[model samples]
Target: MSGGIHADTAPKPVGSYPHARRVGDLLLLSGIGPRIPGSDAIPGNRYDADGRLLHYDIVAQCHSVFANVRAVLEASGARWQDLVDVTVYLTDMAADFAAYNAVWQEYFPDPATAPCRTTLGITALPTPIAIELKCIAATGAGARR
Candidate 1:
């Protein structure tokens, strides 16, 4: 079954796109950020009077982003355990990867059941968020595969 999915519980996307799309036995999530729903607030953001980004909390962003992903997956009738792959982006990997990896350990404790992952260091995001997640979770027959 192939269809586009929208998660009302998830924060509205920054651009024109559905929350996720289901193709065959897979649910492919869009780039999910740490923006809080309804308010579209990014956690851990601190700015100066000039709106220049100052210090941001990678820990808060990590948890918030994971929550957003969970919202989308649950809305799309998928489970965190069903995730087969994930791609992550971080703006300051050199400075934040350790904290980020620590947070990752919290969500995904066991390597055996964890999804395959690839992470990349990027210059900046479209928004002020420090991290974003791209996820692929299994469904229907794919869950059995």
Candidate 2:
């Protein structure tokens, strides 16, 4: 029991993979970035014509990434509350974690209701944005998985 989920409102994936894959009752999302849908615009970074990163804003990037994640989850018939696990990648954890955590709280709210998360500091991401998110969500009985 498997399938792929895609949302036209979300940014197209950089690679040839679906936005998320459903296996059994779970939807596993690909790494989602802050890029706007239907365009190469990233919400928090200034980039040159050659795609060089000029400056970054973790707060704006976090919001856009979460919005993208929400779009994918909804497309898969899941909600933010259905998320059970999350993995976050940040290019500079030391410099960005505080701001990222702040925006994260706005989404998850209560600590008890928040999904389990593991955030990693990485050298870079597929794009110039500072943040990305990968999530696993539980699709209830009505979902096709």
Instruction: Give the TM-score of each candidate.
Output: 0.95, 0.92
Q: Which candidate is the best by lDDT?
A: 1
Q: Deviation in angstroms for 64 in model 2?
A: 0.1
Query: What tens digits encode model 1's per-residue C-alpha lDDT throughout 25-140?
Result: 88999999999988767899999999998999999999999999999999998988888899999999999999999999999999888899999999999999999999999887
- Model 2 per-residue lDDT tens digits across residues 1-145: 5767789989999999999998888889999999999997888687789877789888998999999999998888788888889999999999999999999999988888789999999999877889989899988686333
| lDDT score, candidate 1 | 0.92
Model 1 stretches with alpha carbons more than 4 Å out = none
Top model by TM-score, which number?
Answer: 1
Indicate the residue-level lDDT of 62 in model 1. Answer: 97
